[model samples]
Target: MPRVSFVHPKGESQEVEAAEGSTAMRAALLGGISGITADCGGEASCATCHVYVAEPWIERVGAPGPDEDDMLDFAECERRPSSRLSCQIKITDELDGLVLTLPESQ
Candidate 1:
């Protein structure tokens, strides 16, 4: 399992173990972490799963694809260089200690 950490805009952090192949949004929702709604499930159509990959993990996470990038334009909060849709981030051994910061709105 990979350990994913969700940091709220308020500075709160919650770490949870995510099963392999699961998306970060799924892990957050199932683990009851705040700030990730995942309204469109794990589909790439929604931007509600927006999160910012923390430093050190940014390069490892890579950049979002075309569809993800398009959907991000509709995110409830402002997009940043590190903005990403959690549904597109699949859990893997390489992401063991991935850290994400949730936006203030969603």
Candidate 2:
């Protein structure tokens, strides 16, 4: 399992152990982390699972794929260079200790 950290908009945080090959959104939801909605069920068609990869983890998470990038434009919250859909991020051993920050709104 890989440990992942999620920082709430208000500055609260939680660390969770996630299985390899699972999506970030799923891990968040399972751990009761509210930031990621995963409304489209990780299909890449919905923008509800929006999140920001923490600055240091940005490059490690990499940029969203073309389809995901397109959906991000419609995200309810403001997007940034680090904006990404949690459903699109897969957890791996290499991602152990990955950190993600939640936007105030979805």
Candidate 3:
């Protein structure tokens, strides 16, 4: 399992272990990480699972695909260079200890 740390805007955080091949959104939802609403489940249709890949983890996580990028434009919070839809981030051995920051809103 890869452990992911979810940090909120105010600096609070929660860590959860995600099953390999699963998405960060699924893991966060299952772990009860509040900031992720996942309104469209893991289909990538909703920007509700928005998160920022902590600077150090950006390269490892990479940029979003075209489809995901389009949806990100609808995120409730302002988007940044590091913004990504959690549903688009797949958990893997290489992603262990990845850190994601949650925006103030979905």
Winning candidate number (lDDT): 3
Candidate 2 on 1-106: residue-level lDDT in tens? 9988999999999998888999888899899998677877889887888988988889889999999999999988999999999988999999999998899997
Question: How does each model score on TM-score?
Answer: 0.96, 0.95, 0.98
Residue 34 displacement in candidate 3 (angstroms): 0.3
Span of 10 residues, lowest total lDDT, candidate 2: 33-42
Write the residue-wise lDDT of candidate 1 on 25-93 in tens digits. Answer: 999998999788888887888798999999899998999999999999988899999999999998999
Model 3 over residues 17-72: C-alpha lDDT tens digits? 99999999999999999989999988999899999999999999999999999999
Superposition error at 27 for model 3 (Å): 0.5
Clashing pairs in 3: none
The TM-score obtained by model 2 is 0.95
RMSD of each: 0.7, 0.9, 0.6
